[model samples]
Target: MRRRRLPATALAVLALVTAGGCASSPPPPPPQTRAGHPERGAQLIAQYGCGSCHTIPGIDRADGLVGPPLTRFGARSYIAGKLPNSDDNLRRWISDPQAVVPGNAMPNLGIDQIDAQDIAAYLYTLD
Candidate 1:
């Protein structure tokens, strides 16, 4: 019996097809907001350098991974491992993370009331 060899172009096409099948799907789009506040919240997270300690979605430069990832915060039952994950509680955590979780490395970024509220809104939509 004699072995038959495939042409170079045929082998390349087969390789490309196989590789494309193995590629992972793209990530889902970020949650939408009525008032478009998540954009502002994302800005605030960058401005305050929250990525230095925690991971946030939609912000590519935030590679810290030191703290918990905020990908699906809306599904989380608790915030800071204690307080319930509610709008008010999230605001508190963002404004003063240490207050919610004492001895935690996260610092108070001095976020004002409105920014805290916007951040909370954004975090809640991570689900």
Candidate 2:
């Protein structure tokens, strides 16, 4: 018994397919802001105990591994690996994690829209 070699054309097609499969999707747009207060957002983060789960920069005792580290969240292109990293998206995610990413480890802290915006504003400053 012996193995048969694939044709040159077959190998070329395979290579193209493999390359396409490995291609990464383009990143989302940069972060946007509207009616947000960074100072309030920072205060809210601590008030809500967000540091207990996320590693927020500039916030003392905000070193946790339960969630992704938010060292440069403002510079990121996406939120939860899907939604664009805009202020609106961040607000929505903060208000209700389940709605943004179902079954996500982040819980819905019952945060209102205003507080969410504040939080997003603070996160944008990390960049």
C-alpha lDDT of all candidate models, in order = 0.74, 0.87
Per-residue lDDT of model 1, residues 18-124, tens digit only: 77653254323333442327778888888888777778887758767788888887777677767766666778888888877788977887998789887777677
- TM-score per candidate, chains pooled: 0.67, 0.78
Top of the candidates by TM-score: 2
* RMSD list, candidates in order: 10.5, 5.4
Given candidate 2, what's the lDDT at residue 113? 95
Q: Model 1, poorest ten-residue lDDT window?
A: 27-36
Please give the lDDT score for candidate 2: 0.87
Error of 2 at 63 (Å): 0.7
Model 1 quality (TM-score) = 0.67
